[model samples]
Target: MSDDKDVVIKEYTAPAGGWGSMKGMSKILPKEGISPDVLDALRRQNKPEGVMCVSCAWGKPAKPHIAEFCENGAKATAWELTSHRVTPEFFQKHSVSELAEWPDYDLEQAGRLTHPMKYDAATDKYVAVGWQEAFDAIGAKLKTCDPTKVVLYASGRASLETSFMYSLMARMWGQQNLPDSSNMCHETTSVGMKSAIGSPVATIQLEDYDKCDAIFVFGQNVGTNAPRMLHTLQECRERGVEIVTFNPLRERGWERFASPQSPVQMTVGAPTKISSQYHQVCAGGDISAMLGICKYVIEADDRAQTEGGERILDHHFIAQHTVRFDDFATFCRNARWEEIVDESGLSRNAIEGAARVYMKAERVIAVYGMGITQHRYGIDSLYMILNMLFLRGNIGREGAGPGPVRGHSNVQGQRTVGITEKTELAPVERLKELFEFEPPTEKGWDTVESCREIIAGTAQGFVQLGGNFLRATPEHAAMKEGWAKLPIAVHIATKLNKSHLYPGEESYILPCLGRMEQDMQTGGRQAVSMEDSFSHIYGSVGKATPAAETLLSEPAIIAGIAKALLPDNPNVPWDEWVGDYGLVRTAIENVYPDKFANFNERLFVPGGFWKGNPASHREWQTDSGKAEFNVPRALNASGFAEKEGRFRLVTLRSNDQFNTTIYGYDDRFRGIKGTRMVVMMNRADIAHLGIADGDTVALESDAEDGIERVVEGLRVVEYNIPEGCLGGYYPELNYLIPLEHHALESHVPAGKSVPVRVRI
Candidate 1:
């Protein structure tokens, strides 16, 4: 509507998720060329026998509501089930270079891909090619590839059936470089939780939301990121279950919500208040705030010990279930209030108030997102949180545990199905026995490591199952040229993106059936399974028709490549596996018997099945044979000891977007419109720089590297964020994050808190 295209500065005071969400959902119909039949897709989404919502990894309820999907999930479904097609004719008109010039939103608007295409460098255009011919060409190049030099990147959106085959295919090819989308988002949580408890995923189930006495959310924006979670949060609030939140941005999602699906709430025009305690912690202040809370909890317990009153801490549970509590308590007891207040941008009163709530609650669930996991000390921050949870024995209980808010439907599930590159984490002997292949035991590169290899030109071949590898990782600009110089680059995808344009010597785009589209193979229609963040495995069957006859399921495509590349995977039948996905499940069962027994039978069951977390049952898989408490390197876990003029820059995703895919320019939650090129800053920070709200500014990172990372022409908007912090949309601000700036243990890029300065 605004052809002037200026980012509107008006604050949207309207409640989140009411008529606005319905209007937003309505716009998708025209934009995506969606037919009325998309209703079938929606009706089936998140249902027990239907497709899992591709928008997020939030668990589906056992007894799902009438509308189990959220606004974003609807848009994602419409985008998948769009009638618009990028056929061979469309590719014939636009060259890769020309298409690369288009914006991400425009590229996605081009709609679903309907044919396999190969890049012709002579014309710089992609031309349609037969699936067999494409697979043959790619496999021939892959056969000559160095196992260590090859990069097989999985997007985490692929089904478990595809992921299982993907891992086996990489190992069968003697390739070890298998990096995933998890390496960028929740890898810190995985590393941290796996070290403390025995689980890498959430320790709580969907039903736990109903039973929890209190919920403590850290750094995750529940409304926009996982809007479906808001329904449960609303229910908990109605039940008088307290919810405490710690985040840099006072996101609209947590402030107020009007569930559009509820006719009663809509008619009443009243929104549910979400957070009981909203702490605006500074970016990278998770550890400091948590330490303060721990210190308060410890002192409260000490007072009880002296007064001979009931002890505040779960001492008996601590004594039985955890190790090194004494060390952890002593560490917390020494934390200074002044340091905590300075770093967290909060008061001692606030920290103690939260601690009091924690002490009183018998059952508490601790949930966190990327805001806590994309900092330099991300793992250490989680360690402090885990230590706090252990003090009360939150683990191995019904309504309490640590939950890492994972993006993508199955990012965690990918790792669960043997997609890890770490030698220690890899099932080497088990894979050898099951697949009858000498699986690579040596460690391989992660996202950053793979980028380094690409930049160094050491890695020649790159294959992506379903993500934009270059755009998704940090230092993307630095590796763009290197990625172009590779010998072979292949993408298995449903639509075209900028990643496909970064063609190597030979590049191909293999169109695959989407999660919402029925995947018909030689064995008849197949139902792919996905594991949610709650570690719940459910089968997703696409009820809608396929976009084209040429489109193949991801599992079938993997099998095709396997047939051409590794003709006889002796222990495996490429033909039978694609013909029947159930056999792949059985093979997966064979590999991970204890966890995935009878995967096929349990997959389609109502409410599906939970792959039990070891910590949930108090079965410690650690060396101590019990949960261990981690002592922090220091209470100053952020390491940002208040350098003047440096703002803690947090890279955020717009409500209109998911991962690297830009849905639109507007971020409705934050009142951003007409553009994604805006920065949200506190009023004081804007005044400090002598700039008014909406002033165009330039940002330069202080990563201390010789390279001068900069992004100019950004409009600054005043918001209710912490004073010293600034927020901007990701992929645009991704340039500020350096390759070396990552979580030490997890190696996930430290994107959440990049040190940057703004210039008017």
Candidate 2:
């Protein structure tokens, strides 16, 4: 066991997924004490008729190697199928009050939740209770509140089958507040992309890697977030697809990659160089940088027209398939160069260099992640990306379109199956026609609104399917107060988290089977389905047995509560659907015939089925019936990045963590070890702030709400980040972000480019 100071600030120059990939497995796998058949469990993930990797939303390869999973994927598998268990006896040894004080690492490291446990106020600890007894009490409390007062929240861990059932239950219960993990992450992709092209889903496929001339990735770290993507990237680079990365951090993953699956490369051969070019743009500078590129391309076209030069913009596609082209072009042309350079933290030469790469390629695929989404101007940022792609007619092509890699495996599918706060989705009317229930027509609360309602005592109860809502959201201290005031709360989970400690008056932590475990229901056996980031539907059946005898499947637990709440759910056959997950898929197909027509039929296919994006066919679902162009309002989207000389903050994830789950202390890529309380700053900024490397400090938010929010005891480490920028790991640093500091359109928290000042 080493201390925080044991590993100083050091740069890891190895490519992201080589020998460094094995560090996590070698360190944490033995601690998990998993069964000897763990290799079988690993082999089953992301395969044909196998379990989906809980690590990320990266698509599965149709013809994958023997080891299809990545290092992070393997860590997630080992954590899920660990032999350690937090049985009833374990709970008896620790009180709820005492356990609430534990760090997130310790809470998850407690291992699998084994049985239905309820908090006993008398003893200040949890006691095992019967499933029926717990469900009955929860239903009674829920019945006391109106639909508008109750929240049905879900994380991304559940299957689409379970999500479909959960969505049905929320509607059947007359509760339209259907919020899921998407609200905090990719919701911008939904709102912005649809506004630009009339479709929220990506028009990308795994095979597109072969035909794409160039790949432009913005604001996403592929190596740590989705290591399995390296195989695709390596192959694409090998075939001459130019890879361009725009990020604030000079990540090693994009520099080069040595796949663990390749024998010769892992031992003797040189690794594949992933990125042909890498640009370390300042945080929140994507919009300005994007504007610069669009400005250059449009100007080049103007020059080509006057001087008889090579072609630049695709004028034919713009005329045939889009509207508002002139407005977008005028906005780009009117933009000044000095403002673009200043806001983008890049010089004229670098911005022009990136534009050259874009102009050289005939077909390009542009992908972005949370870096562009979790901000005040998240939607605007995404719209700019579309505006750039639209100039070249990237949509409706063989090797080109927009790709948004989601953090959760099936978050997009959850929204597709009707888990949303929006009242007017494509399938919303279909649900009413089939179920004969009038779902609330008014828009419901998102994550931000729900927290506001819960905290203000306007909301009465909360039913979470599978997420760490408290830790995942901003304003952690206030959320704790809201969790205490709820009269009824129910969490269907596979393990313990901090959110579980603050139990409601009648709260129950219901244990459920994980994705790695077989789900044996009354109908015999079940296989669940999840949608990848690219709209590909996959069937994930568990290989290992359940951790405990009392644990039930997610569908079963959701059905039980649905029955208790609506004793006579006449329109829905809860028993039938829960018994057989295939029936849930049938219902999904019934509600969404166009998207998932063959439901179960195409689920088990070798690579699964892709629900086609209509935007890919040059068809629009918007009012204009054509791909639309949207212009950014300003270069500095956040409006606070240049205010008061505050440092721009960007939240980061380590190689050992996924979402909020911390696997180990070491982040092999960024050179972090034995600590999560770190704030990586530029050496010049450290000098300016009168601080040195390894100095302890606190960060205070510059939000206008007049609230004092800070995270103390963060170690400062000098890195290659932009001078006025800072980077820190989140859930630990999540406290400093004010809840109100989120996207105005999509409401995703502005976790990426928050204005903060270091407190000495």
Candidate 3:
């Protein structure tokens, strides 16, 4: 875009829906109510006007026609149907230099692209190109470079079939460099779950929550991040199940929920109370909290043994299925209570109280999100959760286990279908057996490595299935420069985004069909399968018409590119597979037979199919075939400690926000309406900083790896957050994330921890 920065623009924020108003509105309007703007835009486009149907990858499915759409989905839909248009003429009028001055939202809100375009650096303008020409150009570029030099990046929004075919095509071309969104969010779940159990997925089904005596939630914000989960948490609360929440901030969703499904609850303006006990644990202190709970559970068992002959753990199951009991016990004994209490920011008594709830409950479910996953010692934290669950034999049972609430609709499914950069030998052998092509044995680059490769000039081309990669990634300037250095960049997306603007020497934007849109092919109306957070594979039939006639299905686009690139071969049925997605699923079934059994037949079921994860039932797949207890060392003293008066800044999603997209800036639960500039800090911290509730300040963090980012003019809002922890909305503050701050094992950016000083 523009060489100079400092472009001034007006800011806009949308209004909020009140709890009472929202309750009343949920009745008259469908769960996913159609916005007036959305309806008007559809009518203008000569399409049917109505509420959109939404089924998140999570277990919750909204009603048909009036399905529940999250705030992010609303924003996504609105973004797709924007009144603005960026035709070839618009591109010709403004050079890339001028367009670069515009804010990300302004550039994207300009509207849906009507035709395939290529960036011409000579004129600094994008020129419309025919599909054939674009494909030919891509094929020519691929022919020049080694397959290993090309990195294929998949987003969470990509369908399982598309991801599978994309991965297959890459393998057929002999490249293992398939970096995906998983590297950013739930890689820990994949690595941790697979290490703990043979399969890497949550074992508990949606209905299993009904059988749970108690539910423990950590780090995840059920309302803002995964709103559909609020209903299940509410149901458990109504059924008298104890809900314990361990998070640094008291998220609104964890406090109370108003279910639109229940008529009486909606009419009476009653909210379903959630979280019987809310513990404000320090950020990156989850391991300490979990260890404390385990310590108390062990002490209770010891006391029971002394008094009579009762055991807290499932002794029979542990003895039969596990190894390494004495070693684990020794580690637990060596863990000091003082360290746990200090690190967790909670009293030993509070942890004991929480442990009592865990001990008394026969069936317990612990669910966590990015909060626990986005830390330097995140994997250790995750292992601790598994260890605690295993101690009481809480896995793979009817209602007890560890549930990692994954973001995106089909992120989990993408992994199931083999979108991983690090593919195992078994999958590689299976692929060779099925497709008659030897899959790459080398491990591919992850998100971080991909960037490094691109910057180092080793990576020649980049292709994204979806997602705003530049903004979402750490080290924005470096990432942007690396993208610019690439010879070609191809993006398959539904709407315009910041990533689309960061063009390479020759960039192409291939508009694709959205999940809500119909995909009519030669056979019939095609349906895509998505795996929810719980590992349930279900069919998603698109209802709305395509945003543009030129837009293609993601699979079709990939297949077309592959056809153009690869030499014609009998083994590669590229065209046949594109015509029908079943071929892709069949290949996926061959690769991951343990999980995707009869993938085509099972997807037709109304409620979908569940992938089995044996570890949840105490079937440890570790080296010892038992859950391993990892003793964590104290977190390195934070850099914030060196900065005398600064508080550790933790980025959070607003109730109205999702990821980097701001639907409308209204977080009703936080009493934040029509604004995203607010920062949530503990009252004590605010007082200590000599700042009142409504005072404006600049947030500055220590430069990491010699890179700096300063977010200024943030309005301070006092809330029930832990001391030394400050919360601000993501993406707006994503710049504050230092390039060096990332999880040790997962390589996920530490968005939860940024030492910052607030200046009035």
Candidate 4:
């Protein structure tokens, strides 16, 4: 392993996707042992016998190309279907303490878990155990604990059927304490968008991008995170659609991109320019930047009317489909230009230019990601974007709407399947009537609250369907200590992660099948469903053989535990549901009669069915019976006032990684290699600090919390980042962000912005 201090940074001169992506894939695919059969499986994505790409939540095109997967999607598939195994002999050779010394990448490279294991503290080793024994142990511990003290965590990778069964297990156990990955990623989209547009999901379809006259992307890196979306952007660019972007990094995706799938472009080395205009907004300044754009639009509308030009504001749409327009307009107009310029880190001209592009287009689509949501005022930022769209009647119309692109495959679907901490009354009543179990109706803890509850000793055990909970969450030290002191922790996973290594007093690691693997039950092969970002419910069937024969399907594992926990009660048919997933779909349809009436039948179609959203068709389900504009109150400060030498650090993902999974030790697009622990700082900031580009530095958060939050020995790299703002890889710098420093209403961790002091 190369030293992080000896990192390499090059001038990334190539276009986003063209040859670079293809070359990287060529290197990794063969290394991961992805054969021609896997390529055939990937080509059949979104088909009847194919699984959804286990990557970002970018919706698949209505009529997808023959090769439907993107570079990142292919990497994700290869990462999961790697021809490697962690058998009982491997575990026997390495103790838990020995494995703990290995890096996360090495741990992942150790390969898939082939058997259920129990952590033996005496030997500090994990020993293989029978699936029945693992389930029995978990059930025994669950039976002893108060249901409220049990925290049920779900990851985005879990299928809808699996999530449904897990939700039932939590509810049947007399609790609603189900905190999931969505709480950490896109909860702001749910809470804020529901308040504004009456729906928590994206209103636009995947085909809408083709029809959209203008597209605005904020905070998200489309090239790295959702690479497939770049193909749509390239097409939009060809059609002369205006693309505006606001992000701290002037990402290569926003500049130009050459699609590898395009033979002509790949051959000539010519690329389609994506963003028509790009602005580097400072960290934590998304709200201010959005306000600036809205203000410009409001001013331009007034000017057009005064000068006897064409009407800019949509009066008809405003009167019929929206409310409180006057109040929203007043706030935008009253916003100070100086404050907007200072906070946004963009000049007045740039903001106005973006506004002009927006005003010129009749149809507009606005998309955002965690960078906009993972902030103290994230909900407010979402409202600001909606307010801008409402001003021009962009939403609830053809080719125009808000698109809060969620992270993780089927994350939105997991939420739709009732994997929530707070249980609604109607769902509780339906569960009681259908399954013959009285579900607890009281609200439960979210991700942050669950962590706090565990630390406070209110929670005694934890059970997760997937995800690296300890590394993904904030306050790593606290979570580690809390887990170490817990009475029980159970993980249903495919690979070895940090969560499994650091166990409680009694920990059980249950190995499960991956998405690419076939799940055979008593009946036959089972197909599961997933909902994409656009609310499209579709069936996904795994084609690859199981990585290990001993691995059980996620639904089967959950059913096993359920059977053990509720053996005496004969009301629920766990065995039947696991045998055939159709039974699970039937139950789901019964729970959501209107949304999913003929769920199984719809799977036969090409694109599947659209779970109709009222807001998508201009029907408002809000309290006002219309879309409401919000007037965010003025804030005295955007965040904690750091000292003169301190910087606002924003943690982000690299090109080589997805969430916490590291595919390689390089951020190829950003010209970074062989190191993940590096901070990106402005050249001028580096000069002012009297530090060189390769100098190693330490970062300590400016927090009053008694817990010490510091990350040491991170090399610094000079880049085009905003002054007084720094960028680093996530799950690493997540240390500097305290658990309490999260979005106000949504409680999503403020990973995008943290007050930190950089030291030599």
Q: What is the TM-score of each candidate against the true structure?
A: 0.98, 0.98, 0.90, 0.98
Model 2 regions more than 4 Å off: 1-8
Model 4 earns a TM-score of 0.98
Sorting all predicted structures by lDDT, with the top scorer first, yields 1, 2, 4, 3
Whole-model lDDT per candidate:
0.86, 0.86, 0.72, 0.85
Q: For candidate 2, which ten residues in a row score worst on lDDT?
A: 1-10
Error of 4 at 211 (Å): 1.2
Candidate 3: TM-score? Answer: 0.90
Give per-candidate clash totals.
0, 0, 5, 0
Kindly provide the TM-score of model 1 when superposed on the true structure, using C-alpha atoms: 0.98
Model 3 lDDT tens row, 1-760: 2212422222212112224325323332242244564554333221112222232356643222233454444445555544455667878898777877765545665666667788888888888889888989988888888788888998887888888888888888888788777788778777776776555778788788889999888899877677657766777888899998899987767877666556676566666678899999988778888888888887777778898868897777667765666676677767888888888889998888899999999998989988877776677777777778878778878988888898877888787777877867237887787768778887887887887787677788988888777778776666777888888889887656677676877798887776666788766777777778877777666656566788788888998899888777676687777777787778778778888889888775644677876675566667777665555544321223435676677788765455655444446566665456667888888888888987888887665455567788788888888888889887767777766677777777777877677768
RMSD (CA, angstroms), candidate 4:
1.6
Instruction: Please give the distance, in angstroms, between residue 293's alpha carbon in candidate 1 and its true position after superposition.
Output: 0.8
Q: Candidate 3, after superposition: displacement of residue 173 in Å?
A: 2.0
Model 1 residue 198 distance off true place after TM-score fit, in angstroms: 1.6
Q: What is the lDDT of residue 649 in candidate 2?
A: 91
